[model samples]
Target: MADDAPRRDAALVALDWGTTTFRAWLLDGTGSVLDSVRTADGALTVSERTDSARARAAAFEATFAWLCRPWLDEHPGIPVLCAGMAGSNHGWAEAGYLDVPAELSGLADRLTVVPAGDSVVHIVPGLRDAGPDPDVMRGEEVQLVGALATAADRPETVVLPGTHSKWVRLDGDRVTGFTTAMTGELYGLLMRDSILARLATGEVGPKASAAFARGLEAEAAHGDERGLSALLFTARPLVLAGRLGSAEVADYVSGLLIGAEVRHALRGDPAAVVALCGPPSTEDRYRLALERGGVSVRIVEEDAAVHGLWRIALDAGLASLTPTATPASVLTAEEQPS
Candidate 1:
């Protein structure tokens, strides 16, 4: 095959469409990525750019066509599997949710189908917890599926850290329950508009690591008794007292917030080892926090979404493996074609 030749083995187009990021992968019969596209054309952005529901849907369709035109053109009738906010009520199609304790395998049976130009898109439904304290998640469910598939051991607890960090509890393939924390959102708010942001200067560097550790230690010690409000306030005073450098304030605050989240999450659902699935930077921070909380960590591949979409596609009969198809190992970040 030429470098630019169309892949006749392409079996599925996997999409991970979130609030502010869009990623699509063209996968072969064995789930190896043949081609991929990533952009900032998220569901939220697409919704905001349009007025009415009709316009919003049209915009989403147009965006999808624009991004995957080549793949759709070359491989007509190829199955497209999407997971995330794109299936939300306000998104291209309302895929709805499966209330917990839902079986992970059953997700393949409840896909929402949307006709986009000449292609049919299968959107994965989100998960919902409807007890006294209710919560819902859209995109993280697929990541969970991927994480479990690629995990060395099926973890009892899984943490997907992001803008809204998810702490998921699973028994085998069943998702018993989960909780969401506003750790990342809070960090963004404080860094962008809080009083601490005024004093924070310079990039977080090697010196910031010690400050971050201090914040985690402080949260572990005083977060329960003194409260997070008091712990966060101490950041300002430490800088004023010539103890913490201005540049280290961001990492210090990050440590405090992530530490508090980890401490509380572990207390609620203690586990021996937790599967941490996320980007490298976010995973590093959570690994530190979780280890500090005395739990062993197993890092799931960051590109778990692609693997997840592949699994769901196979189970749903949207795609199939060929007899001649050779299984390929998951590609690392550097190994993926640009």
Candidate 2:
């Protein structure tokens, strides 16, 4: 007689679907990544291609199926969990929000399920700060969960840098409140459409680090008194006066924007230590600014999304730690199970 048991170890399909990017990972029972994929099929892109809500949902479903076809075919009925704009009002399905003072552990229970072919995809809920100054975040919450899991000591503050930088305050596992700043968006505007763009000749190079430091110093000196508008205009004069190179304009602008954001964020919520969660590019800049502000920084990997999704899967009873088998194609020769 021949043995007829399951041979695949892939337990869950983790997705970090955002505004302009879609990333997925194949995780085994132990939360180790077996394979991964990334693309530009974001929720916004999918929605823009369809008009009606019904059509949009179908498109999202089709996109998910197409992206994870290989994994799904190899491991039928594998649990799928998604975090980010995919659960927003205009995305696949509105997963809703867990208002501030919300506990992170409760996230798994509030998931919204969307049926895609033979798989049921669970979407995580966004966080809402419904105070005098309102703010909302979709995908950063999962990063927070993963950051906390990997931290030796709990950080009072967690900053997620992106187009809209988020300053999140955590009291244990519960989120008390949070704020958002348009630092990255401002950098994009100034480097692309503003007057600074005309003078920006090439990519930010090694020499741009000095220019970036100058921008940080400039912002630190006059940002509070003269305001960002006045300080931003000085970039043009610096270039014309031969003080700043045309290629360095982008880095200088980035420094000014990130400087102001870090300064003000600290003033609002003073923290002795902050856990910075973002990609290497933004992480290096933020680490510089935060250290300059006299705050110790703890760095978390950008791939926190996969760990976060795995945690939620276990909490939701969607995954287990029991060793399992996975398709031979999904694993390298060294990763093959006995």
lDDT of each: 0.90, 0.89
Report the C-alpha displacement of residue 169, candidate 2, in angstroms: 0.8
Give the TM-score (vs. native) of candidate 2: 0.90
Error of 1 at 91 (Å): 1.6
Model 1 ranges off by over 4 Å: 1-8, 202-208, 324-338
Identify the leading candidate in terms of lDDT: 1
Per-residue lDDT of model 2, residues 30-138, tens digit only? 8989999999998879999788889999999999999999999999999999999999998999999999999998999999999998999999999998889999999
TM-score of each: 0.90, 0.90
lDDT score at residue 42, model 1, on the 0-100 scale: 89
Q: Ten-residue segment with the worst summed lDDT in candidate 2?
A: 202-211
- For the record, the alpha-carbon RMSD of candidate 2 to the native fold, in angstroms, is 5.2
Model 2: residues with Cα > 4 Å off, grouped in runs: 1-8, 204-208, 323-338
Please give the distance, in angstroms, between residue 195's alpha carbon in candidate 2 and its true position after superposition: 2.6
